[model samples]
Target: MSLTNKAERSLISHEEYEIVRLTHHPDIYDVAGEDLQATRKRLRDLQEKERTLAREKRRISRGKAEPRGGSFPGTQERPSQRKQVFAAAVKRLSREIDRRARIAARAPQAEIAERALAMRRENFNASHAAADTANEGMQVIASRRRRTTVHPGKVGRVSQRTKAAQARRDAKG
Candidate 1:
C-alpha cells in the first residue's frame, strides 16, 4: 500500500492476482471457457495498472507515506480473447506459486528482523537514528537464532546503551 517494499514488506504478486481473480475477476479464471487469453490479459493489465500507480504514488510521496488505490481497466469484451488471456494467466500463476514458495522458504530472516526493529524504533521515537538500532538488532538476531558478531558495521549501527555505561562510570568515580 504505502510502498511497503521500502519497509521490507511483501508486495502482491501472481498469487494475489489469482485470489483476486477468483473472488473478483471471474472473467479471468474461467478454466473450461474458450476465452483463456482474454482472462490472462485482464490479469496482467490489472497488475500492470497497480504497479504503475504504486510507482507513481511512491515517487509523489515525500513526507509521511500514504497508500494509493489501484484502478483497474475494464473487463474483457470478446469471449475467445478472454479465454486466451486466462489460459496464459493460469500457467503463469502455477509457475509463480512454485517460485514464491521457494523464495519464502529461503527468506532472509535476519535483514527483515533488523528492519522491523528499526521501523518499530522509528515509530516509537522519531529521533531514533541508525546508532539507536543496535540493541534491537541484537534482539532480532537472537530471536532468529542467527550467529553474528553483532558489531556496529555488521549490524548497521552502534548500540545506544548509555545508561549502563553511565552507571559503570559513576561507580568508578
Candidate 2:
C-alpha cells in the first residue's frame, strides 16, 4: 500500500472537500453509503411544506376578505357589473368610429386625410393639451412683461434683433 501525508489523507477523507484528481466520482459519501430512511423523511417533509405553501398562496391570491362597495384595488366586480362597463366602452368606440367614417365619406379626400392625421395625433391628446396650456401661460407672461416694461419701443427693437440673430443661425444650419 502507498503511504500518504497527514494533510493529503485529511483532504481525501474530508466530506466537503472533494478530490476530483483522484477519482471520477466527486462525492465520496455517495459512493460509500446512503441513509434511505433519512432521504424518505426529507422528501416527505419537503412535499408537505410545498402543499401547505401552495394552499396559503392560493388563499392570499383569491383575497379572502369581505366585499365592500365601489372600485377598490384587488377587489374584482361581478360578471354582470364587468359586462356593463365593457358594453359602455364598446358603445362609445362604435359611436366614434361611425362619426369618423361619416366625415370621411362626406369630406374631400385631402380633408379626410388631414382629419385622420389630426385624429392619430389626438391619440397623445393629453400631451398636446399640456403643451397648449404651457404655451398659453408663456403668452400670458409675455403680455404681462410688455405691459410692465417702461420702454415698449426698445422692447420691440430688442425682440427684432433677437429674431434676426435666430433666423441667421437657422439659415446657416
Candidate 3:
C-alpha cells in the first residue's frame, strides 16, 4: 500500500500510468512505436498526465479540496502525506517523458553514425586496393623512363690550357 501505488491505481488507463514495481526489473524502453508522430503524441499524453497530477496536488495544497487520505486522528493520515504521493507521481511521469524524448532524439543520430562508419570502411578498402594496384603501374613507368647521362665538358668557364690549344689550332688553320 505504497502511496505511489495508490496514485497509480487511481489513474485511468488512458492516462497510461503504470504501477511502480518494487522488484528489480530491466528498463525496457518502449521504442516499437517510436516514430516522430508517435513520439510527439506520447510526449503530449505524458505531459498532460503530469499537468493533471500537478494541478491536483496544487489544489490540495491550497485547501481547495481535501487530499486523498483522511485527516482524521484515528486514520492518522495527514494532508502533507497525500500531497507527497501526488508530487512523487508527477515527478515520476516527468522523468519518464524526458527519458523518452532523449531516446527518440538519439535514434536517428545512431543510424547516421552507423551509416558514416560503413562509408568510411568502404572508402578505406577501396583506397587500399587502388594504392596496391597503382604501385605496380608506377614501378613499370619508372623502369621505362630514360636514363640520365653526364657531358664531359666544363660547366661555367673553359680552362687556360684548353684556350691556348684552341688558339694554336686556329693559327695552323
Candidate 4:
C-alpha cells in the first residue's frame, strides 16, 4: 500500500473506532445492548483480526513496491520511540512492495512458466470440463431457439403482408 493509503486507512479506522465507542454510550446501549466492555472488546478483536489478515496479504503480495535506496534503508536513526515504531511499520510495508517490483523489473523467465505449469496441474482441471459441458448445453439451447423463432428472410423486410401470411399459416396449423 502507498503511504497515503496507510494514512487514509488509519484515519478511517479511527473514525470507525469512534463510532464503535459511541455505541457504548448509556443512551444508545439501552436499546442496542448493555454490555459496553464486551462490545468494545469485540470491536477491538475484529480490528486486530483485520490487521492480521492485511499483514498476511502483504506478506503474500511481497516484492511489488519500488524501493527508495538513496540512503541506507534501516540505518535511518530515529530519535523518538513513536517515530521509530512508525518508521519500522512503514519500512516493512515498503519492503514487501519494493521487493516484488525489483524481482519483476529483472525480466520474466522460466520461473513464471514453471508457476503457470504448476497452476495448470491444480484444481481447475475439473472446472475446465464443467465449462465445456455448460457450453455444449448452451449451444443446443441456442440451436433449438433458432429453429423455433420466426426470422426475417431478406434482412429487415418483414412487411405487413409477410407478417399476415405467416399469421394465417400459423392459424391454419
TM-scores vs. true structure, each candidate: 0.24, 0.20, 0.35, 0.22
lDDT of 4 by residue, 39-93 (tens): 4455455445445444544554596554344554231222132232233333433
Kindly report which residue stretches of model 2 are placed more than 4 angstroms away from their true locations once superposed. Answer: 1-73, 109-173
Q: Candidate 3 on 12-124: residue-level lDDT in tens?
A: 23234332221112433332333334544554554455566567667877999877754423312233443444445445445565777899899999999999888767565
Superior candidate under TM-score, 2 versus 3? 3
Q: Per-residue alpha-carbon lDDT of model 1 for 51-128, expressed as tens digits?
A: 555455555566445554455434312323333333444565555455555776667876789998887775665443
Clashing pairs in 3: none
lDDT, residue 126, model 1: 47
The C-alpha RMSD of each candidate to the native structure, in angstroms, is 23.1, 28.6, 19.7, 23.3
In order, the Cα lDDT scores of the candidates are 0.48, 0.42, 0.51, 0.45
Question: Candidate 2 lDDT, tens digit per residue, 10-119?
Answer: 42224211222122223222432133233333433433544444454456568974344445323131323222322332343344445556776777987879987886
**Candidate maximizing lDDT:** 3
Query: Comparing candidate 1 with candidate 4, which one achieves the higher lDDT?
Result: 1
Candidate 3 accuracy as TM-score? 0.35
Q: Which ten residues in a row have the lowest lDDT in candidate 2?
A: 16-25
RMSD of 4: 23.3
Top TM-score hit: 3
Candidate 4's C-alpha runs over 4 A off are 1-34, 63-173
